[model samples]
Target chain A: MATIAVIDYGMGNLRSVGKALEHVDARSRILVTDDPATIRRADRVVLPGVGAIRECMAQLRRLELDAVIREVGSNKPFLGVCLGMQALLTTSEENGGMEALGMFPGEVRHFTACFAEAGVPTPGKVPHMGWNQVRQTRAHPLWRGIPDGSWFYFVHSYFVPLLDDAWTAGMTTYGLEFTAVIARENIIATQFHPEKSQTAGLALLANFTRWDGTA
Target chain B: MTLAKRIVPCLDVDQGRVVKGVKFVDIRDAGNPVEIAQRYDRAGADEITFLDITASSDGRETLVQVVEAVASEVFMPLTVGGGIRTPADIRRMLNAGADKVGINTAAIDNPDFVHQAAQRFGSQCIVVAIDAKRVSGADEPSRWEVFTHGGRRPTGIDAVSWAQRMAASGAGEILLTSMDRDGTREGFDISLTRAVSDAVPVPVIASGGVGCLQHLVEGVVGGGADAVLAASIFHFGEHTIAEAKAYMAAQGVVVRLAEDP
Candidate 1:
């Protein structure tokens, strides 16, 4: 049985993420843990987060789970959702500017001026709350069974602007084109909350469970 | 593509069971909140709001269990409201799997509660629920006044201005319900909904008095609401979420189609 460890540094909704994993695969052992040893032994790892980036990082550092995440997240089949995805970037403009795990070479920026600068119509709310379509930038395993242009539930203000297109897997338009999903070897992350994204989201999680970290 | 307008089914839970009533009176059991939430999830409800009518400490414990049950079964954003009084109450709900905490009376008691909660748990998770009643007369300046204590008392705060204040205070969304129209199914207070939605930059979930599918559409188009929250219409099986989405889609309002089961 594949054991997927959902790292619980105590910032995000760990239970829901664990429940979603359980709902997806009954055979897989969905362990919500903060112990570095348990995380290291797991076949796959998930980093989930919500709320302010500064607080999220503070908790990660306080628990010394930051180093564990850096080790387990880099080598294992990893998935990040919402703030988890944001924390993987090099830095975030939130809280004046905060350092991140830098797993993905990019910066998380607020959707403040992209719309106005592009001369597009008035963009939606700041948090960009609710469902929006994700346009797949490249083919990946996680897109299996989920149709193109399918809507996913999103609730965030800051988004990552990827410095390298090689890692960009999906993009969505809120203010302008913002990276919604990121994929590279052994990793898949999304700006949206897959646990709260309904059927399509469940499908993606199902795919993740079966994926071998290949694009 | 444009952002789809949401159809959220609200479950008023009392002591762990889903209940509904007329203007917050004569409450009766509907069904299991978790079962209903899963049904809505499969039927394509954009979100679910579980309002705990019993606001006591014991009630809070019951609601936490209810939320955990529903969260385990349903995979969608769940907003839990009803007696949230402090930042700790909000944190408890979120810890129990609620995506957002809807604050009403407590926010009215200490307006800064909204700011504090939003500041602590990102504004996206802080929703300010305003129960407003139309206070209009020929002699008086027609406006809606905020009501608390289950819509039994008036707080003298103008509905529109209060919404603006809450938004400025860091509330990410407004759950605006018209007291007069609530439970009547006459229709949502489009004028009041419009006023608040226009006043706040955040998403406004126009709630209360949704009698039919057209009201859902009207809630988004006419009321300018980002989402429509209905209780009785959905709870009583008078309307289905798929039916409502189909109705909204036909009206040229973008809505997610229910996945084939």
Candidate 2:
């Protein structure tokens, strides 16, 4: 039985994320402790988050899980959800001058100014809440069995600007095209909350659990 | 790019159990909310709305346990409505794990409540549930008038303008239900739905008058609703989630099909 450890960084939807994993018959534990030993020993890790990017990074630093996350992402299956996924980037435009985990080469920027410049209405919104469809960029193990143009729940105003085409697993349109999901080797992350994405979300989690860590 | 249509299942909860009957009477069949919520979750439901039908009569405390149970058990987004009168009620619902809080009568009495809740919880967390009935008078222009207290009293507020006002006042979403069409299993009021959808930039969920899968599709494609919220058809097992999504897919409506459960 694969033992999945859901990193509890004192933020994000903890209970619902755990229930989503359990729904797929996976043994899961919500670990808030920054103890490296427990994370290193787990078969899989889920970094779930919600709120500002700077705040999330600060919490990760406070718990000292930053180094642990880097170590685990190199060799094991790691999943980052919402802000947890955003933290994998280099930096963010939120909260004025805060660095990300620097796992991926990109910056998290706000959707307000960009949407306004494009002449889109309803810009500068704090939370982009509702259901939106994800356009799969290329075939990947994480999106296996999930159909093309599947709608997933989203609630965020800031999104990741991908370094290149290689890092993006899926893209969703909300006023404009935004990176919905990304993947690199053993590390996979989604800007949308898969836990709140219904069946497609559970299928994604199931796929992550069965992944052999081979990209 | 066209917006994707949403499929929503509404659960009318009376004392923590999902109860349904014609015209919202006589608790025909009852099942645990957690059980029904899990079923909807598996069915690829875009969102779930829990109308606490007994909250006002039974008090807010009883509904808290129901919301907590469903929120803890179900993973998808949850919206709780019925008897949510004040900012405190909205706060309690959100604290109980409800992603969105729906307001009806209280919002009608004091339109400021919508703005107040929106200011406090953010517009995304505030949903205005409008229950309207088509007026019969020739001078009325076939408009929808807002109904209050479980659709018992008429507020004479035009549903169309009210929808626009709600959006302007900071409502993230509008759950519009036609009282005449509800429980009738006839079909949704396409014109009414289109009117509201056009009036608001925010997403509009069409509720009431869903008889079959085709009705659900029409609710999305023709009615211009961002999502279709159904009750009796889904609760009575008339059509499973797989069937609905398959029907939707065939009709060119983008829907998340059910996976192997």
Candidate 3:
């Protein structure tokens, strides 16, 4: 029995993520837990969160789940979503800058900069809250069933700007193209909420259940 | 390539029963809220909204169960509205697996509550629903005012200005509903929708008054709405969501087809 643990660090929509996992695969045991021991013991670990990055980091550090996340994230199959995706990076421009888990060499930035950098024409809304097309830049197992330009539900102000092309798995454009999906080694993360997205999202969850964290 | 215009189905659920469309449309057993939600999901509704028009407190709890039941099997974004007063109310809806909560009368009563809720639980989840009535006469300048109590009473607040204020206060999206066109099913008040959509940078979802698929297309093209919401047209089996999208796509509106990813 593959016990998949959804890490609850006092942030993110755990119910949807947990239920989405159960909806995709009923055979696997899904546990939405804050217990580090259970997370470490699970075959696959999912880190999902929402809200501000500063508060997210504060809660993670206060609960002392940061170190455990670092450990499990290295050896096991790790999935980061939304704020959890930003938390995995080195630093974030949110809340006057904050240091993060540093599992990856990247920084999170707000939509203000992206909009300003694009200059004038305001690509879209601040919180890109809708179904937008995500073009897959590279092929991966999670992208196996989902099409290249599948529409995913996104509602966020901050995003990880594309730095290294190798790390980018999927890219989406609002006014400018930004990193929508990032992956390296056994880790995968998405700015869009797969659990909330309709069919393609369910397919991603179903794919994740069967994925062994390989490229 | 672009952020497609969303077609959302709004269901006014009461005591776990879908109550709104039944009153107007001659539908067969329109009580199953989850089944309707699932059908909408199948037809490619970008999101599903359940307006909790429950009069009693116990009925409010039933709305949560309806949301939970639909969310369990159907994988789509859900927004819940009606009688959400405090932080506890907001928390209850979000905990029930609702992706967003629509705050209308409460925001009008206390605009600060919108700010507080957004600050506490990011602006992404907070949506301010505006019920607007055309206050300006035919000869006068085009203007709309905010209305409360199902458009029976007027708050005398400017709808466009209120939408700007709510967006400034941290509302991620604005759900603009036209009271005059609401049950009429003529079409969306395009001028009113354009006013709010231009006033605020946040996405505006045009609601109330969608008789045909062309009305949906007009809601996006003329109204400049990010998304369009309707009840009778879809619930009464007039047209499926897929047909609406196809019509919109044919009208040169960029929409996510049910066939595409």
Candidate 4:
């Protein structure tokens, strides 16, 4: 049986994510924990987060889950959701420039701030609450059963501004194109909330459980 | 692509049991809130709102249990309203697995509560439920007035401006309910819905007075709301979430259709 560790640094809604994963595949033992040993032994890992990037980083470092995350994320199949996805990037403009895990070659930016920097109109809202369609840019295992233009639940103001497009697996448009999903080797992350996204979301979670982390 | 207009089913719970009444009077039991929420979730409801109608001392504990039970079964967003007064209340609900917390009476009492809650918990989790009644007089333009205490007392606050203020104060969404058409099932107050939807940058959920599937379509099309919420029609089995989505989709409104079971 594949054991999945949903990293719990006490920042996000870990309950819903764990429940959704269990609903997707009951046989897969899903454990929500911050214990380094348990996380290290898991076959697959899920990093779920919400709230400000500064506080998220604080909690992550305080629990020393940050180093464990980097180690597990590099070795096994890993998935990140929302702030967990953003935290993998180099830096975030949120809370006066906070440094992140520096795993991915990108920086997180506010919706309007990025638009203004790029000389474009403001997107719809700050948090980008509710559901929006995710357009797949490149084929991957996570997109195996999910449709190309499936709507996923999104709730965030800041998004990853990809410095390297090679990692971009999916892109979505609000006022401008934003990185929706990024994957490379053994890692996959999405800005949208697959757990809250209904059918397509459940399908994606199912795919993740079955994924071997190949391109 | 345009975001799909959501059809949310609301459950008014009193001591762990789902109940419905006319304007908060003559209440009768409906079913278990957790069971009803799970049924709606399986039926393809976009979201579920569990409102603790009787937010009594022990009712909080029951509501927490209902939320936990429902959250384990349901996979979509859950918004809990009624008796959420402070940041701690909001924290308790979120910890109980609620995606959003709706503040009405307490919000009116302290406008700063909206700001504080939004700041503490990201704005995406803060929802301000505004109960409004259309006020007509020579002194002011034909506008809706904000009502608190389940629409029994009027606050004299303009609905449109109050919504804008709430949004500015960091409210991620607004749950606007029309007191006049709440239980009448006539239809959603489109004008009122439109006024608030247009006034705010955040998403607005048009609630109250959902009689038929057509009313739901109108709530999205005519009212320009991001989502439409109904209770009695769905509770009474007049329509299912799939039925409402089909009607809205046929009317050229983008709604998430249920996949084949």
Best by DockQ: 3
Query: How well is each residue in B87-176 modelled by candidate 4, as lDDT tens digits?
Result: 878888887888899999888899999998877777888899999999977586669999988888989899999999999998989999
User: Candidate 2, after superposition: displacement of residue A189 in Å?
Assistant: 1.9
State the lDDT at A20 in candidate 1.
Answer: 92
User: Which regions of candidate 1 fall more than 4 Å away from where they truly are?
Assistant: B139-141, B259-261
lDDT of 4 at B187: 93
Docking class for model 4 is: medium
**Model 2, A1-215: lDDT tens per residue?**
55778887755446677767776753555454456788888888889876556667777888889999999989899999988888988888877857888899878877766687678764422356666778888889988899887767887767876457788888877676778888888988998888887767878988987887776
For candidate 3, list the clashing residue pairs, or say none: none
Per-residue lDDT of model 4, residues A1-215, tens digit only: 98999998876578889999999998899999989999999989999987788888998899998999999888999999999999999899998999999999668999877767777654465667777788888899999877788888888989986546789998888777889998989999999999888888989999999888887
Q: Candidate 1, A74: how far from true, in Å?
A: 2.4
Worst 10 residues of 2 chain B by lDDT: B252-261
Say which candidate scores most in TM-score: 3
Estimate candidate 1's RMSD in Å.
1.8
Query: For residues B1-261, could you state the per-residue lDDT of candidate 3 as single tens digits?
Result: 878889999998878898664333443346699889888888889999999877899999898898889889888889999999998998888877888999999999999999999887788889999999999989999999999988889999999999999999999999999988887878999999988888898999999888899999999999889999998888889999989999999999888897886
Q: Give per-residue CA lDDT, model 1, range A48-150, as digits (tens).
A: 9888999999988998888888887778889999999999998999989999998887688887655566776776777789999888888899998788888
Candidates, ranked, DockQ: 3, 1, 4, 2
Please provide TM-scores, in order, for all candidate models, with all chains considered together: 0.96, 0.77, 0.97, 0.93
Error of 3 at A214 (Å): 2.1
Stretches > 4 Å off in candidate 4: A114-123, B138-140, B259-261
For candidate 2, lDDT tens digit of each residue in B1-261? 223466778888876678876677666655878888888877767778888887555656777888778777777888899888888787677757687889988888899999988766656678899998888676756688898765789888999999999989988889999888888889998888988887886778899888999998888788778788988888888898778888988999866555422
Candidate 1 achieves a global lDDT of 0.88
Off by over 4 Å in 3: A120-122, B21-29
